[model samples]
Target: MASQIQYADVEVGTELPAASFPVTRATLVQYAGASGDFNPIHWNEKFAKGVGLPDVIAHGMFTMAEAIRVVTDWVGDPGAVVEYGVRFTRPVVVPNDDRGGLIEVTAKVAAKLDDNRVRVDLTAMSAGQKVLGMSRAVVELA
Candidate 1:
């Protein structure tokens, strides 16, 4: 296993290896089942369209979870992340039939903090749309 990244030695503009994950209908259903957030909009097409959604959509949290995996994977430990947040600049707009696939995560070191922590900025996109999750992560490295 890769050791926790040592934070103090990091530099500005450092780029982390990118990661891509797919969000399919089955995965969304699984997430819905696991999270107990079985809102109709997440799985019901008619309901989503009624609410003006193009189709069923994945939960924002789900995308966020996938986005964070990129950092945790690069850092070698998800527990190393001390702070993380993002702004939902755009909706996933998952199709009630099929949510788009290939949610890719690309990240770079935006800033470095004291005490072995560094800020990571990320851009995530899927279906050719900017899904602004995994926006930032501050990790404590060994």
Candidate 2:
């Protein structure tokens, strides 16, 4: 386990070390297997493109889950997360070829919500467009 981040250490408007998680068809399929979210739009590019999207779309929850790695890693434990939510602002399209569409996720401490908690705002992008936005979470510190 990593060293615990003390509550006194964080300040309002501080930024967390950002992270990036790439998305691909295989990852979407793997996530579907592990998370039980096997939406066709996540893995089937043809089906997605047929429906008018640029390509296969990553699952909304899948994107959120990957982005949480940055927060949980920074906070040093998953248990530190009090609440997390994100509005699906855009679909993260995964290209069919190898390497797929890479999602870049950056986060910052938006505010000190309470004595032991801070609100973290996240932004995820892919293909030079916003894939996830208005993403916020509350984390408790030791």
Best-performing candidate as measured by lDDT: 2
TM-score of model 2 (CA atoms): 0.92
**Tens digits of lDDT, candidate 2, 12-84:** 7788888878887888899899999887888887888888988888898888898888899897889888889
Candidate 1 worst ten-residue window by lDDT:
93-102
Residue 62 deviation, candidate 2, in Å?
0.8
| Pairs clashing within candidate 2 | none
lDDT of each: 0.81, 0.84
Steric clashes per prediction:
1, 0
Which residue ranges in model 1 land beyond 4 Å of their true spot?
A: 1-3, 96-99
Best model per TM-score: 2
lDDT of 1 by residue, 1-142 (tens): 2336776567899888899887777788899999988888877888888999877777888889889888988888778888899988766766534535667888999988887778899998987899884489888777
TM per prediction:
0.89, 0.92
Candidate 1 residue pairs that clash: 56-96
Q: Candidate 1, 96: how far from true, in Å? A: 5.9
- How big is the positional error of residue 12 in model 2, measured in Å on the Cα after superposition? 1.3
